[model samples]
Target: MKNILVLCTGNSCRSQMAHGYLNTFSQGKAKIYSAGIETHGLNPGAVSIMKEDHIDISNHTSNHVDEYENIDFDYIITVCDHANENCPYIPSKNAVRLHHNFFDPSKVVGSDSEIHNAFLKARNEIRSYFQAFVNEKL
Candidate 1:
């Protein structure tokens, strides 16, 4: 099975959403992990959005990348520009790296519907991207 790591500035939003979608898409074909340079805890907005799509990420933790140094990952994906720019060197020698700056819905300030739509947009984009990743890579 492929071991995948998704990284971000905070393992709170985009990275978390990507992790959830990748896990659901992989369907046990891959071991998906997500972390950040710093843990800001899981974003409730992210969780709520994933839950709407039936992928529960509420149980996922906000972890620091240092905690995963021991594992040999097959892929390391940075889900935001901040993470892609600041990602530390992980010793997973064979890991393929990928990056996509998914929009942060949590940063949107608007009405409830607009906020929900922002999360939905991010969630859909994440779902689409990971679905392609699994199809082509996993």
Candidate 2:
């Protein structure tokens, strides 16, 4: 099985969403994990959006990249530009680093419905990108 790690700044939104979709779509072919430069608990908005897709990520906790220091991953994908820039060096000769930036929906300051919609858009986009990447690249 391929061990894949998705990374971002807060691990609250994009990375978390990516982790869920990848794991769900990949079935058991990929062991997926997500983390950040700094740990922030999973966003409730993210959980809600994921639940809409019938994926429960509410139990998933935010993690720091340091937690996976002992484990080697086949792929380390940065899901945002901030994470790509701030990512710490992992001592793995064979690890493939890839950058696939996604817009941060958490930055959207609006009404409750608008905020939720932003997350939904982000979730859909992430799913699309993940599908393309898996089918065409991986």
Candidate 3:
């Protein structure tokens, strides 16, 4: 099975979403993992949005990238532009690096409804992008 890693600034939102989507899409064909430069715990908004699709990420623990330093991955995907630029170099030269920038839903500041709507939008965009990625790239 191919091992893939999704990364973001914090293991709170975008990376967690991507990890859930990839695991769903792969159907055990791939082993998926997610980490961040810093661990801030999972975002409730992201968990709620994912639950709409029947994907539960609420049990996933936020992890630091340092924990996987010894593990090699087939692909390392950065889910935000900032993480893409600042991501650490992997020791494996065969590991493919990809940048798939997603807007930070956690930054959306508004009423409860507006924030929820933003999460939904972000989730939809992530699904679309990941669907195309798995179909055409992976």
lDDT comparing candidate 2 with the true structure: 0.90
Query: How many residue pairs in model 2 have overlapping backbones?
Result: 0
Which window of 10 residues has the lowest lDDT sum in candidate 2? 129-138
1-138, model 1: which lDDT tens digit per residue?
999999999899999998998888898999989999999998988989888888888999999999999999999999989989999999998999999899989899999999999999998998899999999997
What is the lDDT for 54 in model 3? 98
Global lDDT of each candidate: 0.93, 0.90, 0.89
Clashing pairs in 1: none
For model 2, what is the error of residue 10's alpha carbon versus the real structure, in angstroms, after optimal superposition? Answer: 1.0
Q: Clashing pairs in model 2? A: none
lDDT of 2 by residue, 4-103 (tens): 8999998998999999899888878888989999988999889999999999999898999999997789889999998999899876568888898897
Residue 39, model 3: Cα distance from true site in angstroms: 0.7
Q: After superposition, how far is residue 11 of candidate 1 from its true place, in Å?
A: 0.3
- Candidate 2 displacement at residue 27 in angstroms: 0.9
Model 2: residue 71 alpha-carbon error in angstroms: 1.4
